[model samples]
Target: MKTSFVSNLAIQSAMRLTIQQTQAELLKRSQEQTTGIHYDLGLTLGATTSRSLNLQRELDRMSAMKSTNAVVTQRLSASQGALETMQKAAEKVRDTLVTYKGNDGVDAMKILKTEVNGALQIFTSAANTSFNGEFLFSGINTDVKPLAEYNSVPPSAAKAAFDTALTNYMSANSLTDMSQFTPAQMQDFISNTLEPMFTGPGWDANWSDASSQNMTSRISASEVIESSTNANTKSFRMFALASVISSELMDKNVNSQVRNTISNAAFGYVEQAIAGLNGERSSLGISESRVKKATTSLEAQQKLLNTHILDINGIDQIETATRVNTLKTQLDTSYALTSRLQQMSLLNYL
Candidate 1:
């Protein structure tokens, strides 16, 4: 067997190239190695990783939705609390007025009158309940002060009754699905709630500033209230508080007769408000439960996704080390063979 200079050089070059290529490939594989190039290993891990990425995106959306819902829920609960407090106050006034049966009924009326004024103040304050700078009872009028400083001109009766009742209703019944109040709910509030109050006894020309600030804050309701079946309804909910008014405590404080009127109206109205609040609270409870369930569901999906990612992108240290060792052996063997081949010449073989 004879080898010339060109052939010898060629043999050495070929061996060096083979070793370098193999080493490079081994290193690349090592960096991103996983199982299943071997038939024994199934694609579960890879599939899991792929699934994980998709699940992660969904979870992100869920997390964001849940956060917003939390804000709404807190405001709602606070509004409900305020309504409950007003209801208690109204009940007290009712008790006091009813007790003043005969001649002392005038006294009863007097006490009732004072009580009614106090209760009205409390109720109005509740109407202005706020959360995160937004009024909970302002019917989305984020900037509108819920209760204008006790006004005398517009005869506070209409505004007071309607505003309290409507806000209480919105606070309780406001669907966590904000979508229920869009394009229609705002208009409904204006026409049904605001217009009625404005046109009624509370229509004072001076409170126009108060009237101008309704339905002020909203993005797409559907953006928050999305659902698989359909979006939330846009109908305005009427609470009992709006329907009943104690004109006794109109623009200014009143006497015993007015107290009796307010006492009679406050109880029925507050009872109605309570019922509405409970209904809305029940709905929110359901949503909270669903959100919790979704969180668990997403967490489950995350596990599968992680497994898939491991299969696709994560390295299998055991298998990688094994394969790399094998390639290293082959490379060493080729190097040795090339060295021998390069050193050989015709004279040496002879």
Candidate 2:
């Protein structure tokens, strides 16, 4: 038999390497046991790793969309509340006009004027409402206020333009007092001048900074909806015109005939405003429903993708735990053997 000489140093080095490898395996199996997933996905899944990566990427995208949809739902809810506020104010004015129509009594006229002014303030304030630091009714111009306050100090441009137009109309007609204002004259001025002021470029220049186009949001991969309304719509214009006419002329010294005409016109405009605003509310409600449905669909897809990813990368927890325990025992035995080797020195023998 051939005898080979092996140094204690070489045996200790081999034991040290074995201990290190055993500890590394123990750590890996422990992690897999705790997490119930493979410690190294690329190694275990091999060629299927690409499919797992793709599924995980799609799942992340759906998660991001769900977060975005939450913000969109909040914005839409806030917009709906603002529209309700405007609608309530308009309804108050409508009720006042209907209750006190054709009555030129001092108390009734004062009440009518107060309600009209209050409605205008409420309408403008609602239209200029902001959410998340952006104007809800400014459409694409989210940073800009939609409607200027009509009763501001020194008067807003809209008020100034309206005053100027009235002054010019009075001068041209040579009317000394509003009581001398005839129904024919008032109707002509309203149709030819006042209506255009509220509905034309004049409104953009003086009253509203809102865009005609509304804000739209993507609710799903293939679906988009308008998430906001704008103050530049015809409904908003009609509400402003009705409020202006009632505020400026309702308590004037005009005869009952002209006052009745003015009341009738305002009543008609208010009715239209109410109907149009309701339509806008309905449209937003539809968008809210679609957002909810899209969220549901995304959640279902996310659950399915998550299951697929787990199937690709998941480990058998019971088997992993058994392997981990076995590695721990081996590592402990190796540690003991290494300590024994370290102590087996020639000095100890001496």
Candidate 3:
């Protein structure tokens, strides 16, 4: 038999190393037990770690899209509310015009002008509405205000342009007095000059800073939708025309025939505005529905991906807990043995 001498230092060093390793394993198993997931994914999953990483990345992407969809839904809802407000304002103006069409009374004209001005204010305010620090009616120009106030101090460019157009039309036709403002002359001016102003580049130059292109948002990975409308729409232009005609020309010192013509034109424009607004609202409703469906799809995909990720990286919590408890017992025994070894000195015998 060969007898080998082993020093206490070597035995203590070995025990210390064993304790360190057991402590590390215990910590890992404890964490796995607590989290119900593998503590070290790369180590446990090995070559398949890339699969877990990809699934987690996709899950994160879906979460981001869901957050964006929440914001889109909010913006669309706010825009719909604003449109409804504008529609109501336009409807009020239309109803008032219809109610008191032929009445050239001072009070009726005053009421008509007041209502028209009110509607213009409401429409302008609604068109300039902002959500999440972006203008709802600015189209692609989200940071810019869409519509200038027509009744602003010193008058807006739109108001100034209207005055200039009226002045030029009066000057060109050599109309001396308000009585000379015939229905034929008014119709010609409205058709040839005013209509073109609202429909052409003049509107962009003077009235609206909004873009013709609307704001679009991605509701899903493959789906996109226009999330905003602009004040440059024909509906808004018609509303403005109806308001301008009713406010500027309604209370003028003209005959009933000219007044009726102005009333009829304004009413027609208001009707068009209402219908166009309804169409806009309907379009937005469709987008809202699509967003909802996309959200549902994303949730289902997220759930499926989570299941896949769990299958790849999930730990058996019951087994992990048992291992953790076993490690704790081993670590305690190691600690006790280490303490005993520390106390093992030849001085006691001496």
The prediction achieving the highest lDDT against the true structure is 3
Q: Give the TM-score of candidate 1.
A: 0.46
Name the runs in model 2 displaced over 4 angstroms. 1-5
Better of 2 and 3 by lDDT: 3
lDDT of 2 by residue, 55-150 (tens): 989999899999989999999999999999999988988998999997999888998999889989999899989999999999999999999888
Query: Every model's Cα RMSD, please?
Result: 13.4, 1.8, 1.6
**Which pairs of residues have clashing backbones in candidate 3?**
none
lDDT of 1 by residue, 1-350 (tens): 99754667777787788988998877765554544232222353444554545655655655565565556445545655765664565455445445542222344445655665676566556556666786654553455664543434765554466557556656866634323444344445445655455444343332222332232211122333211110011101122232234323221233434333344444445454545545544554554455455545645665776565445445557877888788888888987897788668778868
Cand. 1 Cα-lDDT: 0.49
Residue 258 of model 3 has an lDDT of: 94
**Candidate 2, which ten residues in sequence have the lowest lDDT sum?**
186-195
Ten contiguous residues minimizing lDDT sum, candidate 3: 27-36
Look at candidate 1 and tell me the lDDT of residue 219.
12
Superior by TM-score: candidate 2 or candidate 3: 3
TM-score of each: 0.46, 0.94, 0.95
Candidate 3, 1-350: lDDT as tens digits? 99998888999999999999998888888888777789999888899999889999999999999999999999999999999999999999999999889999989999989988998999899999999899999989999999989888988898999999999889999987778999999888877888898889999998999988999999899999998888988899999989998999999999999999999999999999999999999999999999999999999999999988888899987788789888989989999998998898999899
